[model samples]
Target: MPTKQEILDLHFMDARYKLIDLAAFLDRVDRHSGEGDFRFDALKAALPLLLSEQQGRAKAVLDALSDPSIEPIEKATTQGASGAPRPAGVPL
Candidate 1:
């Protein structure tokens, strides 16, 4: 099984690759299209905001991990229809 750090490293690399791929695709669209194209303009405007939000979320996760005082997430529990407690996992 991969360690936590290994999983984080892989996730970071994947994020970088995805950003690069998005930029390349945007560049291709910009090159082949008119300067005033709405699609390109909208994407260009949104990219920075998207990147900033992603960075903020990543930083928050790292901060939470590194803070020793922060509690780990407990195994989620929920009451089933029969009124019994059941383990649950939240999807990200």
Candidate 2:
């Protein structure tokens, strides 16, 4: 396994860019005029996980955005997943 310092040295810039990209994305969201979006809500809800000391952040984040429903809908309205849990009118 690589030392912590070695790992950071090799990946810090890539991580830095990702963080900046996330910030910029949020900024663009803020500049737009619109009601709340579930995707953004999911992203915001998962932000705290990045600061968490515990492991499983990735899984936790995925769970946050994933639909909790065990039952399948009669049919999907869209061809793609919304990337956020629960439909707008549906309760989790």
RMSD (Å) of each candidate, 1 decimal: 15.2, 2.2
Per-residue lDDT of model 1, residues 1-92, tens digit only = 99989988879888789889988997777688455443344445444555464547554433333323345446534432221111234121
TM per candidate: 0.40, 0.89
Q: 1-92 in candidate 2: lDDT tens per residue?
A: 99999999999999999999999999999999978777788889899998999999889888888889887888777787888885558533
Off by over 4 Å in 1: 1-7, 33-36, 51-92
For candidate 1, the TM-score is: 0.40
**Candidate 1, position 81, lDDT:** 26
The parts of candidate 2 lying over 4 Å away from their true place are 87-92
lDDT per model vs. reference = 0.52, 0.86
